[model samples]
Target chain A: MIVFEDVSHDYGGGPLFRDVSVRLEQGSFHFLTGPSGAGKSTFLKLCYGELLPSSGKVTLLNRDLREMTRDQLAETRERIGVVHQDCQFLDHLTVEQNVGLPLTATDRPLRESDVSDLLGWVGLGARADALPPTLSGGERQRAALARAIIGAPNVLLADEPTGNLDWEMSQRLMMLLIELNRMGTAVLIATHDLNLIRFAKAQVQARVMRISGRKLQLAGAEL
Target chain B: MSARAISSLVVPGRGQSVWLVTLSSAAMAFLAVFALALSVTSARLAATWSDALAQTATVRISAPPEEMDSQTALVLDVLRTTPGIAEARVMVPEEQAALLEAWLGPDLPLDALPLPRLIELTETAEGPDRQGLRLRLAAEAPAAVYDDHTRWRRPLVQAATRLQSFALVSLVLIGAVTAAMIALAASAALSSNGQVIRVLRLVGARDRFIALAFVRRISRRALYGSAAGTAVAMLALLALPQAGSAVPVLAGLGFQGWTWALPLTIPPLTAILAWAASMATAFRVLRGVT
Candidate 1:
């Protein structure tokens, strides 16, 4: 679980967000909706310990963000899966190798069958040997998801996971995320699409938070 | 897994190309062996040449031609009785002519030339005191002047000393150059694989683990390269045609006895150099990353 208690972040000389706080517990689904440049990606980066908060407490598990050593932060990242908007993949690697990257990075043992199983689960089995440069947008998203979940992490963070997907493909991805939430993983999806959030609300008990004027607030009952 | 075994897994092509390490190792080994040979030869030459030159004295009796033989006899008698004067053999005309022929070539007629009657006085250690003998000879034979070979001995000893120092300096420069080249190569390889590093770090890999891969590869390559160079160098030195009995200088230029063991140290030295350079670059790059 990730907890942000009065956490503040900034860039250069000015503050991006101040005294912002929220707790993400297990088995919960939350959507972070913000206008352009509202620090949604920065917040996701904070969740993964990639960026440090300028002031106040941002705790992932039991460790404070500012105090964790580089090694310790890397260990923390293993338990928290992050999906970038661009889904950064080593273009030289095949889709299967890209999906199994988490295991390789951790020096974990993997059977040949585990790769095929993971690829099939993400619906990328047939494209396993294909390179990342050859994959379509939705396929790349799912590949990124498989890589994130390969370590069986406790928390999942996606920054615009469906940004480039069509409505049907985005819906399919949302269903997959809902299934993961049902399996007890905390999921936080950051996006700008209010319509997507409204649509997701019909199928699950999800809360929507909007960032405006550099403040985070739960959307009104209508949202 | 042990670092060595793990490292062997990553070298692009190892063991298959015998000449890969061979060329560098042979060149380094050859240079190292020559360095050792030069040092030893110059050292021994200085000691032996100085000892021989230091022991003898030459008396130039500049008396009239009528008094030259008497003065020479008087100087010889004085030397015989002096302490530390083992023996003083006056050079015969033929012997003096042979010595002069070395410089003037055989064409100079030594008998026709009024070369002063040179009396070579060979001294012994404990035979005669050099200073006391010189004073006594001057009194007994006023025109007899003693030259104890010190004029030539000092310069010869100094020249040998300089040669030895030059050999040692060359060895040091070679080692320093080798170390610097290896460091640059390691840095280039580190930069080339920078993306691989970022990927590994993102996946939770420690810096030490990542550095081990590079350190192991480079050190092993250096060791192998140095070994081949050393072998070829040794073989080349052995294959050189032996100089015939005439020139003792060439005889003094080779390694002898246990001195051959010196070149064997070069490969390990190269390995240590590569190891230090690779580790330093790895740490610097890792610091930049985190």
Candidate 2:
């Protein structure tokens, strides 16, 4: 679970957002939407302790983000999966190796069968031996998702995960996230795609929050 | 995959830094072997000089030809009664001529020259009291001067000792330079692989895991490079001219007996140094990230 109370953030040019408060409870699904450069990515970063709130406290998994040591932050991150917009990967590594990193990086036992199964589920089973440079954008996003959830994290935070995908590919990726959410993994996704939000709303009980006028507010019932 | 396998995969190994660390370690290790050889050789030389001169003395009698025989007899009598003197004898004219042959040439007419009478003395382990013997010789025959070889031994030993110190200081400087080069290479490698580090961190990889990746690669390269360097240096040393060479120091420049094993330690020591330098740099650079 992640909680932000009376949080305000600034980048040395006035506040981007002020007096914002929100709590993500256990096994809940949520969507964050805003226009370009409206602090959607920054909001996701704050959720994962990548940045500290400028004016208020940010708590991750019941521990104060500011109080965690570098080591402790790493340990906390092991339980939280994060998918980025760029779908970062060690380009030299094979897709299977990249996907298995979450387990291997933490020194956890990795069963090859599990990795293969995850790859199959992400539609990348045939591309497992291919390097990142050879993969298409949709394949890269799927590989990133596979990597994020391979650790069986308790919470998943994704920033514009489907930004580079086509409509069909985006739907497929969103369905994978919905399946993960159904299995009791808290999911918070930040995006500007209203169509994706509407599509996700039909399948799960997802609360939608919008960032506007430098504040976070629940979307109207019309959404 | 094992942890080690994972670590290797996380960091890309292709870069100029790799070759940089390997070549620098090899070059430094080559120098280290020579420095080690010099240190061990000088120490042995110092000991040899000290021991060879320690238990001996010479008595030189310079007097008018008429009194030379009588004064030599008096000096011999004094030496015979000395408690710690094991043996003493007057040098035969032929022996005196042989000693001067190096400087005076082989065909010099020794019989026509006015040469001093020399007596060589060998002492027991607990040698004679030098001061007491000098006073006795001065009293019995003022022209007979007792030389304990201390003047010759002291300066030779001091020079060898200083040579050994210089060699040791050279070894220290080599290690320092090796560490510095490895650190610079590690920093460059880390900076070049910044995106790799970011990806690893995002997946919950700890700094220790990331550091181990670079440390293991760099240290292994150092080990391999230094091993090759040591092998080449050892072969080079074995090819050097041995005893009876024109240069006295060169005669004993290489290792002797059990000391042949000393140069073998250089490669491992360099690897450890590389491990420490790269590990420190990895952690410092990682701290700058999230």
Candidate 1 residue B116 C-alpha distance from true site, Å: 5.0
Q: Give lDDT: candidate 1, residue B58.
A: 79
Can you write out model 1's per-residue Cα lDDT over A1-223, one digit (the tens) per residue?
8999898898996888888899999888999988889888888888887788888898987888888887787788778888888887766667877767666656666565777887887678899999888999888988888888777777899988888778886887788788888888888999887778888888888988887777888887687
Q: Candidate 2's residue-wise lDDT over B208-242, tens digit each?
A: 99999999999999999999889999999998878
Question: What is model 2's DockQ versus the real complex?
Answer: 0.80
Model 1, docking class: incorrect
Candidate 1 per-residue lDDT, tens place, B186-271, comes to 67666766665665565555677667777777777778888877777777766655445455446546666887787788888878
- Per lDDT, the best of the predicted structures is 2
Per-residue lDDT of model 2, residues A55-152, tens digit only: 89899988999999888888889889999998999999999999889889889999989999989987889999999999998889888989999988
Model 1 spans with C-alpha error above 4 angstroms: A12-15, A26-31, A89-120, A123-146, A160-187, A191-210, A219-223, B1-48, B51-94, B116-128, B139-148, B166-192, B217-264
Model 2 quality (TM-score): 0.96
True contacts kept of 2: 0.74
lDDT of 1: 0.76
